[model samples]
Target: MEGTIFSIIPALLMLVLVLLTRKVLISLGAGIIVGALFIHDFNLFGMVKEIWFIFYEIFVSEGSLNIGNILLLSFLLLLGIMTAFLQASGGSRAFGDWMIQRVKTRKGAQLMSAVLGLIIFIDDYFNSLAVGQIARPLTDRHRVSRAKLAYFIDSTSAPVTVISPISSWGAYIIGILGGLFAANGITDIAPLEAFIKMIPFNLYALGAVLLVFVVAYFKMDIGPMRTHEQRAIKTGQLYDPNQDNIPGDLGDTFKPHENGRVFHLLTPIGVLIIATVLMMVITGINNTEGTVNILTIFANTDVNLSLFTGGLIAVLTNLLFHLQQSKPKANTMKIIIEGIKTMLPAIYILLLAWMIGSIIGTLETGEYLAGVVESASISPSLLPFLFFIIAGIMALATGTSWGTFGIMLPIAAEVTSISNMDLLLPTLAAVLAGSVFGDHCTPISDTTILSSTGAGANHIDHVLTQLPYAIIVAVAASVGYLLIGTLNQVVLPLIITFAVIIGICLLLQFLVKTKLSDE
Candidate 1:
């Protein structure tokens, strides 16, 4: 069952249930149980033990605490508290008012979120969380749906990071490319150079980033996103009233001071950004054996540790500001507890996601998918398009882009080197793009969950609303790959892909207009 077609049933079942029921935890739990049963040959007692072991390994690995997972959880909790502190100090309100005066419209707010998402290319997790904290207030003030904000954050984070040469994702990928180059006896192009060249071929990432700006600038609210946006604009409701257990909502926990200043919000965020980057660099230096370079540093950096340290510092900074507030009703301990409580829902989702992901790993689902790709009699011409599609499916099933990268990149390199060396770069780029695309669409994806948590949106709402946008970009990218594979021309195919995206945007906008006129 481990590497057979049966390995996919749990993921497929979980995905279908999530779409039908919109219950993230229950769907993930069901997937975990089903996967565990498969691992234990459907024996109930064996299945129960497998489940227990999965939970145990999540917290304690190899007779000790799982420091990485613990730190990441700590970072999430601290971020929630920091959010509460920001709201309680009136910084979020003040920032919203300030942006409202200058931004003037929802499009500006949305574009602002996209641009910030692009600028913060250090790490996807950091980008997803930090951009939401800064841009949420502005978007909310303009009646932008939390679903849209999550979409903006989710779309830009992975696409931007995957392309940037200095980012964590880029570093890890370059490292893989180095090993592949050495293994294949290809020395003409350096790993960094290869990555840079592949950037243009990463059609999905480029299309995703472009689609974000186009959607924002043109206000092309398609599918379920339009429903969320209309609800926001018409009734000032950012999310569905029926949707319960939102990840980042603070509710009525704390009252903000009237004299809150913009710096109050910016200050803690500044601390978070600076502290996180500083810790990343420091950790990288410590971990590097020799010849410390930017790529190696990023590749070796302890991201969880850096995030935890940054969030801790930021939380303390926000606490200081909160203490300065003259509100008589604000109790320090109570506010912190409320903030922690608000993040518990997000934590539960994340934990269950990890558990299901681990179960999928034990079931060897990705390995099964990759085996199918390896055994296929694919033409070299269709390798780019096929790789893109397969990588998407692998990431979607596994709920992880990095894991997909680890599995697909090596296989892609080997296959391309044997068949068509000319298509090597395109194949790799397509894998990167597809992995990010799948990451954007899946509900169990960590970045997707974080995007919703950051935007204070319902987790399922973010998944559903963002799905159509992801599919649109994916289709355009698939066409671009098909063109490139068949014609072997970069410029023309890229131009055609961009045109497809623009045409779709315009068509959707026109349809929206016609519908509104009808109404």
Candidate 2:
């Protein structure tokens, strides 16, 4: 099954099960078991052993403790505790009350979420998690659905970070481009310059970002997203009440005070943002040799460790604020334990996602897909479009944009360099765009899961609701790539892409009627 069409069966099966049953854990577990069976040549004992090794490797890689995975898990738990602290301290309610006075409409709440997503461009993980904490209060007050908030967070995170020069995503991509340029003997442009040049040509990213604001401003809810939005507006139900095991839903574990201060929420989250950025720079400098610059710092920075440290600091700060309440001191340890309990669902899903991702990699699923793209003898004018579609499909299947980048970007570069060197940057840009687009639509994606966790949404609801919106942006961006391939330029194609997105959004808003009864 390795490096063949059969290797893709497990992913397809997982996807179909997710849509049919809406059970993330069962679907992922089934995928892992099936893929392991294929890898073990259908021997039941060998398949079980392969599954055991996959789980084992997640914690112990090459006889060493996987600090990155452990720290990332810790950060998630810490974030959950911090969320509990905010609620118990009454900070979230207080903040929502304050914002409710100013942001009187759902549109304002949604756009604010989108803008915050854009502003927090340092890392997609941080952006998705932190932005949700900050914006959830306001959005909920305005009756915005958790699914919609998750959509906003997921859509804005990777797109903004992937394009920004100072972000972790930008640093990693620039490093890859530098090596690609060096290997191809292309010296006409610097890595940073090439990255900047590629930004406009990254049609999916630009279109996705723009579409968020348009959707918010125009209430352009279509497909499954419209159903969620209408439910939110009509009955104030933010998500499907029937769904269980939703991440970030802490229930009525603690009562909030009437006089809780907004600073109770802002202060701790502020500490988290500042501390994480500082740690990133400090760690990046320590790992970097020679003269240090922003790019080198980000390229070498320990993101998982930084996130863990930041999360710890924020949790402690939140605890202090919780302690400052009236004379009666609650059982702080119990509250913390309950907070950690809320995150168990998220952690379980994340662990299963990792195991399945490992199985897919072992099966060489992405390699098989990439090989198919590489073998196609398409014309140079269709290279960008073809790469975009293939990269999207590959990322969607593997549920890892970074892994897709690792596999598809090199293949795209090699193909373009051998035929039309002029199409290199556009091809690379399309790959990045497509990877982000696909990542947005996949249930198994880490960012997708985190977005739901942050917004306190059902994971399957987030995945299904966001699919149409992502596909819309992807289609518009696909058209732009087609034009870029034909015209060999960026400006006109991007302008037309934006126009198409706006046109589609407006047409939807005008045609789709919401049957809302007056209160």
- State the lDDT of candidate 2 residue by residue for 118-137, as single tens digits: 99999999998999999999
On lDDT, the leading prediction is 1
Score residue 56 of candidate 2 by CA lDDT. 92
Model 1 C-alpha lDDT per residue in residues 182-285, reported as the tens digit of each score: 99988999999999999999999999999999999988889999999999999999999998888888866777778789999999999999999999999998
In model 2, which runs have C-alpha deviations exceeding 4 angstroms?
Answer: 328-330, 514-519
Look at candidate 1 and tell me the lDDT of residue 208. Answer: 92
* Quality of model 1 by C-alpha lDDT: 0.93
Q: Spell out the clash pairs found in candidate 2.
A: none
What are the lDDT scores of the predictions, listed in order? 0.93, 0.91
Segments in model 1 whose C-alpha atoms lie over 4 Å from true places: none
Error of 2 at 353 (Å): 0.9
